[model samples]
Target chain A: MGVPDPADAELVRRARNGEKVAFEEIVRRHGPAMYRFGLRMLRDEHAVRDCVQEAFASAWEALDQYRGDAAVKTWLFSILANKVRRYLRSQARSVPTEIDEGVIHSPAQHEPERRAIAGTMMAALEEALDELPLAQRACWILYEVEGLSYRRIAQIQGMSVDAVRGAIYRARQGLERRLEAWR
Target chain B: MEMSPERDLGPPSDLLARAAGELRQLTDDGWVRAEQGVLDRVARALRSARPVRGRHEGGDFFLSSTVLCAQVGTRVDLIPGVRASSVRIVTDDVDHLDAVTLTVSVAYGQAIADVGSRARGEAAAAATAALGVQVRTDQVTVDVLVEDVFVDEARDDGGADDAGED
Candidate 1:
């Protein structure tokens, strides 16, 4: 469902021509979404911001090499994903490979009666998302929240399209099972 | 590899669709504010980097084009009764023959020709001063948009009295 952004393309062109403001405009447009993606992946607010900063710096350095083969957002996401992965690896933080069943089953606490259902469902969803493996979580977020196609997700994650589809499928099933009460 | 059954793969599309809708509602207001800090860092980094390449004083020095555009745009913006929408610079093979195209919206009751000329002069001057190179006046093109007049400020000042009288 994503369409090409003509304004972004023009800004990219100007940035390539050494327009700082144009590049800054590009940063303003995509930075928030990139930060959100990084936060979802790393789950560390500070780390995510640092990773996004590094990603944009790297993108600027490599601006001339960008051929526009993919949308700028896709390109930026790929860079941020890789940066987050590298940071996680360097920190030696163990990413849980298995989904935590306990989190899935825990009942929402202190929820208001009026919006109990929606609040409980949302809480369950967040817990289920947090329990997913990094790869699957990234796939789900990109495909579901970001509205990226399977092909774009595959490219960003450096996997085959079928692999991306499989990851999304697994993530969806896990969430569905966890939030079956809401359904 | 053997294929799994469709049932084993995931939930039905409708269920996943509902989940996606609910998840999209989540927001992080803090991250929105944090983005400005990241942008500031980016702007500083870009400012320090060399952005333009040209021959200066028989030697060569680089100027950041981002800085150059901002300077040009700022100058054009400083002119009352007009706002610079976009500024783009194109250089020929020698890099000395620089051409600038500026898109601007002129306020109503302002002469388009005068605003265009002033924007052109200001942009060229700003580029010359910032780039340390003489930018030719003839190479600048001001693309004027007469439709984008700011009526709110005019209305507050009673400046649109003539239009109101009609």
Candidate 2:
């Protein structure tokens, strides 16, 4: 755990006091990351946008119940994780179909050498991520990419800490095997 | 045959870092364009999800706080010598539209008192026109933001000079 962000706390306070702008600020601050998480989970841009919207709306309606126990980011991510799961279930899909290479745009497109290396590595990693089971992938992303602790990931995923760890461990092993060529 | 210890796999730290970086890049690119759209969608969804405020004698009715905030925000922005950087409306009772508190920010260097009064009057008028309800001036509070003082002051001073030459 880290120090609570005062700005986020203040925003949350004002939002709770019925300030629409404060709540909008909260959505703006966290919306992009939530969108990214949705894209990674669902791999559909439209679906990602819908999921992020649903999650924020849900958060806003339930703001009164938010106890401030978790960081606002974590709270939002938790809501988003639930939204993604519900979306997946609603679609009657088990695994996300394929990695959309179009989603991974190079930040420096003109730098040929860096672009080639990053593109290849990113493609490989996306494949590896796709290969992971949904649970393992969720845990891996929350822990490794989002820098959440195993306990926090467990809370978000509704599992034990050990289970989160095991899932992450398996995900890492699978990815390492799939990405050995890059090393 | 069992795999050799030397070949045992581990976490792909470097790959993970690179992937995180790539994912961030992808998100950053999309976000710049999608931010306002996303907020609008979220705002719409939230407003729709709220309970209906019940029927008036005229017909069925529901008032969206989001819409009201936007109206007030627009009215404040249209005021001379002031730009509404942010507008926040606190509704104590969403169903009745009573005890509403409007908080707003105006561009700096203008007469704060005059701007505040005008903003309150305009917002109240806009809300009454839009919602068919009286929004009293006492319900609005204004905060003057000094952060944009330099730019606003420059624009104000330069606008007249440029206009005279033209």
Candidate 3:
């Protein structure tokens, strides 16, 4: 259905004041976004759901620690990134194969040629993505697909903004290198 | 069906692109549901045990975790694709007609030998009886701690799986 008014600040205020209903409201308002963040990072729905839940749980506990230096979305996104990193650490040894689930509508307006090429290109891009280091993968997905800003990415990842830029740059170069052979 | 040439020939570029396209598909329901259930149980326990946090600074640390042990036991062993020689429930508490610790025994080398020491029996239980009591699975090598007896009476709510071991 529809969401309530954008009252994250108010809700967070209530939540900090110990209103679980307010907290629940915040969860309802932001759950989808948080879920999307986890989905992009984990690529495994199970792991994504887990990371989302963990991020929420940790945020609930750590909300008191929030200094209000950033927006609620940025804060929540930061927590989700930490959760994702911790998950990767625990399962670092194993190969994580993420199965994505979204309907890919072919390029609608014009550009059938690019669509054909892009479709083929998308496959190679994904393989390279899967093969890419987790840091690089997170940077690429967050930077290109999600369109998050570098500072936001850094906040999410608990790193310097410059580090985020470096990661994104490295990721872009990797994708470009992979696509070069196709060109 | 007009299959893409990439699918058939599998060039490095075609392979990579196809893999990328397929990489976004989401499939993992069972795992999510199971973990959700575990977290729910955990949340409840954390809430219930918060009251006793100050009361049991040291001695109560072990007592506060009774229900947690059960929760972990259920999660770790209940999942599919696990095998065990046995799951031994080890605890010093030995005086109960029912509601015995759901003891499980693992074969040797399953966990460190020193872990056996943490499986001591105490009059400890969760502050909120409903949450039950449990300890850290990773911290302890409890295959199971079947309760054969206890000095005090436990809740008679018939709340859980009460396997009476003679």
Candidate 4:
């Protein structure tokens, strides 16, 4: 077998010591998930790209200060979350619930009828998610879609475990009411 | 059956489940291009960014701590069984190189003491070459701290044994 890949902690340790390649390897490994998270949170193609890029740039600059208290993935998500918040503050505008053409298209788009329905459902869900308070949206996405644990979400959100639980609970209620038509 | 507005979160309903799945599968036309863009930008920034600098002007010349630590780090990494994680060069008030500290990780089963000695020697040599000052006259000090041990997977014999150490 080929040489085993280095652990994330190992890469972080190497990165702390001024190894560019180690950090780049980290970017390659985690960049896709980060992209997905950004797309779901920000919903704007340009905004997602910018947030992911800036998150990584900030991560590289702050590598020395990383204490490894949290998993590298958790830490990265935290940084990306902060960047997303900063982007939102700088804009100070309403969260756009509209689905862009570039966001997603059904793989089975050949069926016109099915594609239209799928598009509607996707847009509806996006709208429902967008209606949530930013904190609830972030907490819900991280917990449900990303499958991160409560503790991990708490660390990323800088909230207590109980607080994260409450946010997620409220998020579920909001989504359920918003999407009740699908029931 | 009536539904209560105040209800505990249950397992995701069918719609919510599908929505979550769709979120997980999100992709865009520009995803691949954007990811490459980020990597390229980060790599370029790293190459051009000057992280920290220590400049000391002697009678006729100046020395940079950033360059000094980088050179020292390279030298330390060249030693057989150790990889330098961080290299620091401390400059005195007059900008003379005062001390160097090297944090390193050693390969599993390697001799820690030997690795530390070689790392110190290489670091000192590199600093002297960079600063144009003799170790004795400048009183350059080198400290080597072995902070971790890593398995040499390339050298492994491909055994089925897993010892749970990285």
- Each prediction's TM-score against the native? 0.57, 0.56, 0.45, 0.60
Of 1 and 2, the candidate ahead on DockQ is 1
Q: Give me the TM-scores for chain A across all models, comma-separated.
A: 0.81, 0.82, 0.71, 0.81
Considering TM-score, where higher is better, how would the candidates rank from best to worst? 4, 1, 2, 3
DockQ for every model comes to 0.11, 0.10, 0.03, 0.13
| Model 2 C-alpha lDDT per residue in residues A14-85, reported as the tens digit of each score | 775567799899988888777777766776666777778778888876665464546788788888888877
Candidate number of the best DockQ? 4
User: Over the stretch B47-121, how does candidate 4's per-residue lDDT look in tens digits?
Assistant: 222322232454435644545666777777778767777776676776666778889988889999989988888
Note the Cα lDDT for every prediction shown. 0.67, 0.63, 0.47, 0.70
From the highest lDDT down, the ranking of the candidates is: 4, 1, 2, 3
Model 3: residues with Cα > 4 Å off, grouped in runs: A1-6, A93-123, A179-183, B1-166
Candidate 3, residue A92: the lDDT equals 52
Tens digits of lDDT, candidate 2, B1-166: 4233233224447766676766667656555555777678666644322322434469647656555555656666677766554444444464655433444444556677777677767877876766665556555343333223323643553311110100
Of candidate 3 chain B, the 10-residue stretch with the lowest lDDT total is: B157-166
Using lDDT, give the best candidate's number.
4
- For model 1, the local distance difference test gives 0.67
